[model samples]
Target: MILESFDRRTIANLEAALERVCDGRPDGADHELRSFIADAMVACAKKGQTTLGALTEAGEAALARRGISDRKQA
Candidate 1:
């Protein structure tokens, strides 16, 4: 677990995950959506999911739950 304390690596991973998931979104990408992704990453970290892949997956999953698609290349 993260002991509920986030470190540099943890923050970096979450940020990377957020960026990856928000890549296809509009310029602003909607504050609510971004907040949701960030919240998801935090939840995952609190659950001992700190790996970059895991965090990214969690963020992506949050987007999916919001009915958002991976349209990065579209």
Candidate 2:
């Protein structure tokens, strides 16, 4: 599996990116957003962009492409 190819910290970066973006959202309400970040992170890893910064940026960019902002509007 793709995950088996990644180190713990690298995978943690993916989770960290999600938590950062999805913070304060109700449970079960972030499925779509979570998937987007996960997919983007994997795609980045597959393309050899495995740095934490690169992966996090990729996740954020993916959300932006979907019109999902980094922080929820007040």
Regions more than 4 Å wrong, model 1: 1-4, 68-74
Residue 25 error, candidate 2, Å? 5.5
- Provide the lDDT at 68 for model 2: 44
lDDT of 1: 0.84
Please, what are the lDDT tens digits per residue for candidate 2 over residues 1-74?
75698888777877776676667656424787688778888899878887778887887788777664535552
Candidate 2: C-alpha lDDT: 0.75
lDDT of each: 0.84, 0.75
- The best candidate by lDDT is 1
Residues 1-74, candidate 1, lDDT per residue (tens digit)? 44358988998898888898899778427888899788989999989999999999998888887663556434
List TM-score per model, in order: 0.78, 0.69
Worst 10 residues of 2 by lDDT: 65-74
- Candidate 2 stretches with Cα past 4 Å from truth are 24-29, 68-74
